[model samples]
Target: MTNTLEALTVPLIQAPMAGGPSNAALAVAVSQAGGLGMLAAGYKTVEAMAAEIDDVRAGTLNFGVNLFVPESDPSDPGRLAAYAAALASMALELGLAAPEPGPFSDDHYAAKVDYLVANPVPLVSFTFGLPSADDVARLRSVGTEIVLNATDPEEISAADALNPDAIVVQGAEAGGHRATHGQAKEPSESSTHELVTLAREYTDKPVIAAGGVTGADIAQNHFDAGASAVQVGTLFLTAEEAGTKEAQKDALLSGQYRDTVVTRAFSGRAARALSNRFTERMAAVQVVGYPQVHYMTAPLRAASADNPEGLNLWAGTGFAACQLRPAAEIVDEFRSL
Candidate 1:
């Protein structure tokens, strides 16, 4: 198969919502429906990621796998410890032990890349940062298209320097963690359309616009602004094939979360999630740490999986348009866009 997203019948990609939303079934359903489906490898083990890859391959080869480009530990021990101490009360409420500064992790980036290199796929995308040129070349040699995510002009230029097959211009309005190259840096405030226009000045390579795509009209606007395709995440959270938790799915369609805010409360990285008790309570004390903070809050999240108030209700600005329906129907709305 060719290593380009242009092969898709529909110029839409299902955003890779890691943790729970994106999965084998959702990937298969979206790919079969003419849009590109993506598998998230952000918070999964090598074995689990590999298993899902095998499952998706069995159903379709038109899907892509997104990997979190490993970032160096930017967490200060003192800040982490302080944040953990702040979580003591919340942990107690959950009947769990106090939180601690969890160990740093690369999220197994090298091992997952090694696996993908050994077992090639149609496409691979990187977020947070771009992989080394050597790693990019290795994947390219196996006919796997390499795509990188960027949130601003500098990031776009940096990604273009890597000569990726494509670049995903994720706007600030995007749900989930902003794809800023460094965990410490703030994401650009540009809208998806604005970034899509700015991306044109950086590289002639295909630009895929992501963030706040809730309707066909929004997708069309991105295309009009020179995007080759648009990727939607929040809208797919309620899809029938999605692996989104019941509480989250219901919250999205229930009109409970009226607005989304960018906060570091959940994973210690700046991610846009619906305003809730956890976000409000931890907003001030939240620190700039990633996997460690992500790990530190695992118990709190696990204990409140069924409670939307305590969970990270990740959503885009257009989340109000989200509807619970079949994945194909969602993809079809953007067909031929």
Candidate 2:
């Protein structure tokens, strides 16, 4: 068997966009096209993740799975209630009940880890926080390659200590949630090329560049800066194999959304999304809750699926360059560039 990084025929990896966009079909297509495809394990149940893992396994073994490492940031009930009140009117306008904040959950982190340990896979990556050294040992013991996401030089040092197979250096230009270790601190604004260089100063571990990677030139820049590969999410959002909702796909190419902002209004944790009504209105009253605020606003997001302004339009700065073609074409295009 080849080392995970060396096995990639193309040095591009499909970013694991959690929620609905990432699916087994997208991963399979990317893998078949010479790049590594990743299934987003965040916001998914163990069984659902297992099914997707099975689906990917049936097609290719070059794919990977990315999990959100659970954090223990407790949400103040009063703050949660206050933010819930802030969203009340919008919920009512959509014929929904006032948003109810749920207790903080680890998103079934332990269960998901156990599942992966029992049924080993090709690769496993983590974000949000570092997994325990024991967990890393167990996974590595099975020959599963481990990768961790880092947003700054400090995070790179921390992840390096755990001895991951590689580190994904996410720049400020990335979309969706900024994978800061905790929900309390703000993310850094370093560019992908800058981060790759900075992280190399801390550790010799291979760095996989992410964020605002729109085309071949940017990918080459990272590789020139000593990056092993470039992980892209925004470019694949519009791929035909992607599960991106129609509303989001239209918003990406509609010319209506030109800018993206990093705000915590939607999930109570800072994330990058197209500036829209929900983010704009809730910006002031935003609270620091993870799954709590995530669940609190679920009904509103679901009810307003047809209304792009009310949904979490997660896209990176390079979203405008996304092409509406098969994922294989997108991966091949990146490889040939």
Candidate 3:
């Protein structure tokens, strides 16, 4: 077996969801249950991320860390300023003060990379973009298996040039951010099945299917479609051990938000989030930056944390199938397929 599949005792890889949903408890539980667990180190500081790695190490020896590759250009400051002002008005309606624009950085890519190299983890995955050949070679020298996320044939071809251990074929249905190499690139509308097949045509490396994967049937479908394993995110959000917010959980289970749409309103980069009043209102806005827009909306998101109606409830098309069970049980369900 390749390192990608051999690294897993079970054929299920817990999708690393950044910005708070992926936690050590969930990662530890999944690994303990015989699946490959992943920690989302996209938004945390180096110290905080190191502490999280220690937490996971304290719980299990088998797991992986996922990083968000920094964007080449910072988000447009002018657009972020305009969006902040617009969000401030909404904040007032909720009895909160406007948020001050904070200095934004890309999760400190170099510091985090150095920390990982010095304190090696079992597996490391990259999303949003690919790392340089030097970075890839350095991590590989330390025996860290690298997996890069790709959404289309072109991206898969580019990732193949780096000779990754495997490719995470994230289809259009995946939740959170799309893994396009550039911010301005439009993602392909290929379904998980189609994308997995396309990726296999490009590389001999293992392809792990992601996007809207919620149950045994979906997992089985991906495996049949040539995926070495299935990466699931939304299915675990409702798990008892998940770090998902209370309001986000309620909104996903409420059955009120019937559809999921790709919107750039929340984070300058397009992501799949539940359609809500806020998303609908900002649909026409000229938001084209990532962490900048993400930071700009921090105040609004924080103030409306209590109200699910006005917040971004991150979920997938399979949100209805999400269960409030233990991570072990969730892994068992995937294994039974």
Give one digit per residue, the lDDT tens place, for model 1 in 1-337.
1345767888888999899899999999999999999999988999999999999989998889999987754788999999999999999999999998998888899999999999998999998888999999999898899889999999999999999888899998899889889889887899999999988899988998999888889888888899988889988999999999999998888876798899998887899999999999998899999878999999999999999999999999889888889999999998857
* Model 1 regions lying over 4 Å from their true place: 1-3
Q: Per-residue alpha-carbon lDDT of model 2 for 69-115, expressed as tens digits? A: 98756677899899999999998999988888866778788899899
Count of backbone clashes, every candidate in sequence: 0, 0, 1
lDDT on C-alpha atoms for all candidate structures: 0.90, 0.89, 0.84
The per-residue C-alpha lDDT of model 3 at residue 196 equals 84
Single out the weakest 10-residue window by summed lDDT for candidate 1. 1-10
TM-score for all models, in order of appearance: 0.98, 0.98, 0.95
Q: For model 3, how does the per-residue alpha-carbon lDDT over 1-337 read when each residue is reduced to its tens digit?
A: 4664585667888999887778999999999998888999988999989999999999998899999899876666777777777767677887877754446677899999999999999889998899999999999999888998899998999999999988999989888888888776777899998998787789888889999888878878888878888899998887888898888988888778898888888777888889988898888773778777777677778878888767777777788887678999989987775
lDDT of predicted model 2: 0.89
